[model samples]
Target: MTQSPASPLPSPEERRRLREAASLTQAQVAARVGVSRETVRAWENGRTTPRGQRREAYAHLLASLAEETAEETAEETAEKSAQQSAQESTEETEAQNATGGRDMTVGQGARERADTAVRTAVPAADPTEVEAPPPEARAERPLSPAQAFDALYAFCAPALVRQTYLLTGRRELARESVERAFELAWQRWPEVACDPDPAGWVRATAYDFALSPWHRFRPRYRHPEPPPSNASDRALLNVLLELTPPQRRALLLYDGVGLDLPETAAETEATTPATANRLLNARAAVAARLPDLSDPTELHYRLVELASTERLRAAKPAVVRDGSERRARFWTRAAIAFTVALIGTTALTLRTAPTQYEPPVPPGETVLGVPPRVAPGPLSEKEQKLRAKLRAQMQHGPERLAPQPE
Candidate 1:
């Protein structure tokens, strides 16, 4: 038996045209097809292709609608051609009567009238037919804070965790980083929501948290082995581990996280030039380690995909206790004031206290002495004669003293 040929897949343009011609919204088609509007948009934008059963259903739907639109278009074209012919004939007769059967000018006047009739008879083209508005333009209103948070979380949390994992190389640490980052975002939704790149802010915050040393002391889940197919990735990861912290962070932020050089520098707390240098050095080092890898983008993407295997199911909502912040601030200020007052009071007391002095003890009243010494009495006649002899020798040369000694 011969195998049946496969049905042709509808092109993106065909899908869009059929939808438009069917007067159906993306939401309507998505509802009928059991997919999200975003999925339908992806198909129309050529970002993704519907596969398996959905593809067949989608093709059949479009083909049926396309056939109906073609039939309708044919009927409309035939009706318009008939009306134009009738109007042209009527105008030619009127022109001939107005020109009094003047052949030369009658033909020209009839032609002008017929053209004007056709222009006036046909309605202006529908704007939707001219060009469909973008998907974002169709939004009824801006998303509420809660809705915005949910959307942003759904879109960004997994990638944030993945980037964090790449930064920290631990699953639980990555989850903590992502949770803490989202917690902060929830606490300050107004600011984060208004930020130009809210997702970037979250990713940067998570990556920074992951790199913090504090996580080392926190409880962590067991690390999973790298996927079996990514053996070379393990080698690349080893090379990355060997790099200095700043170099590794810069490389990961630039390539793995898909941040620009300046943004990466801001997150890493380095200047743009310095960040660029780190990236350059890191790339060179990785290249040296993996000589067989020429282009590292694929490797970077693979690592990111591997890290993103685990998804964050839900974000923990931030909790704020009423008046807690106010109370804390109050206590902080009170403590500071009390400390200052205590220091000031101590200083003032020290300065105002009088110094005690001890009066000098009477010289005659020594603590352990028996009595004062009395002056010596005059020397005897022999002592006086000896003194006079000594004085005579002093007045003479030292030779007189030396003879006395001999």
Candidate 2:
């Protein structure tokens, strides 16, 4: 059976086309459809769709638009016939008109089937629900980048914080890890937003940040935090923290986060066997500490329970975004300042440094012009005479203890 006409809307691209081809603006369509301009914009962007009376009205408006542009866009319509579900109905209507049976204009025909004018809409096929487009398709949507970032942060932050808490057993570390990850995401938003797994991107980033061994050097994260109040909870947290960082992360990703082994390995940057070994070791440690949590499923639930018992709250998206922007600005200014300083230092050195090389003075050499000393025999006679005169003048204050050279 064909679904109700109100259930489906046109593809976001074609919805905008139908309105524009009819020479109508979004505001005009929105006004006619009794919705806000943003609602109409969202509908056209595939961010959201209209519903209830608004759905009927929006569908009716689109039908009227198609009829107005039916002739002008006949070629476009023909090209899209294979892609559309209503081609048979459209051809039959035109045929009836030509045969003089149930003759009616495009608008009249649309009124008869206004609810189902554009059945090519893939996202809003169910009137009661709107399926999200694939990440690839979402990346192409021309919505505000900030809005998309905020939406993603809001959806993933809280859960991520809890998960990180399980990984590290510290509430502050978990919160900081998530915030820092988002900050990094915002800094490189172009890459992150276009990624096939934006959530995975953020998740991997958070995991890396949370599991960093360097965090142990920070004074804040160095001290052990107070464990959960309950004995079992504290014991479980202790066991988790006791595991090696890799083991802890692997266990958390595979069991606690419900990721498969391959995914856990990829995220942890390890081979499948290594990740499996880490999980096994981590599970063994936890089970040894608390035998009741030996089962992987039970361990997952316990990890969840332990994480929830802690008061882990992520900062608001605005706070995160503002901090990210602030950090980026600070680093930019720092880089510029450092560059200027380096240039000034180089200029100072250039100004003070010697322009010409001056050869060093040579060491003194022995002189060749000095007179030679007299021979010992001639010097002995003069020395004896001098010594006798000196002894006479000195009056021999004390007898010479030993004979002089004379």
Candidate 3:
């Protein structure tokens, strides 16, 4: 015998049990079940019953509602753990900073000890939580602008900075560009927050800022005009200019940016090792022209030191504003006058000068007057002896030095 259609509805007790199990309010259930709260109330109060599919959907909605009590309990536990770890890390950093510059061995030892203590004291993620794909899942999660800003600053700030520097050799310029990008992000926080790659947007924005006219007007400190005889500084400048923006970026990203190979690839949207290798090759082509440094670190430090010493005052307001027009006009007139003078000089030289039949130049002779090579100054007896010893050592089959030169 088949039951009547009235018997297809759920009993009041069953509805109550399902709602309690699923942790849903009448409104929540009604919304999910395609009905009003009043309708749900009538069913729950046993004045009416949902029919057929409506009854099944109501049951399904109740079953799917989240159990709020369990979620809150887990969140509290996780929050406590996170707070404790953060406090420990902050303490550790402070202690390490306090020990700066006494004995290297002592400072290093102190840091190691602090780090070990924090590692031991901090609670590890629970086994169940650890086994879950939280890291993978987080990529899918949405973050508010403030939350994303905090996360990116803490984890990706260093990487982003290095990336910017890689793209632009000018440190101050790169920093300013990154600052502008962050400002833009802040202005459009709500829109940026919804983006799949907010960091990418910032990076692209930085790229644009670096190329802006205002950025060009930004003060770029360089060594004061060296004497004409100072060939080294001139050579360095030429080498620096030879590097294209992308090549410089590759070097900066690899060495200066502090990113591992894979991280750099991800940030730059390169495929794999091969792409990084191509970038490296491009950098090598430019670095090949630069003056050879006995120690690259020394060169880096010297450059940074020089940069720090230079006062980078803002450019003159008038010049930055509309002075370009006046300068352009002046240069245009000057150029025309100079060009006319040059033509007259060439005409006079060609027409008035008597040309004689010239003999072929000697093999040893230079067409342009060649400056004589300067003779080396006499070395002291001790210095001469040291040089001789080094030459002899080099001749004797690659003898290793007692100390590797820094």
lDDT to native, each model: 0.73, 0.81, 0.58
Backbone clashes per model, in order? 0, 0, 3
TM-score of each: 0.46, 0.59, 0.30
Candidate 2 lDDT (Cα, 0 to 1): 0.81
| Candidate 2 pairs with clashing backbones | none
Across residues 98-146, which tens digit of lDDT does each residue of candidate 2 receive? 8886747863665456335453332235656867766644557566878
Error of 3 at 300 (Å): 6.8
- Location of the lowest summed lDDT over 10 successive residues in candidate 3: 312-321
Tens digits of lDDT, candidate 1, 192-280: 98885687778778777777766456554334434325576567667776888788889887777655565677778889889999989
Question: What residue pairs are clashing in model 3?
Answer: 162-257, 166-249, 167-249
- Comparing 2 and 3 on TM-score, the stronger one: 2
Query: In candidate 2, residue 108 scores what lDDT?
Result: 61
- Candidate 2 residue 201 Cα shift, in angstroms, is 1.3
Estimate the TM-score for candidate 1. 0.46
Worst 10-residue lDDT window, candidate 2: 114-123
Best-to-worst lDDT order: 2, 1, 3
Candidate 3 per-residue C-alpha lDDT over 116-212 given as tens digits, one digit per residue, 9 for 90 to 100: 6555655566877666554534567576555666665455444455445434445566566666566666656678777755766777677666645
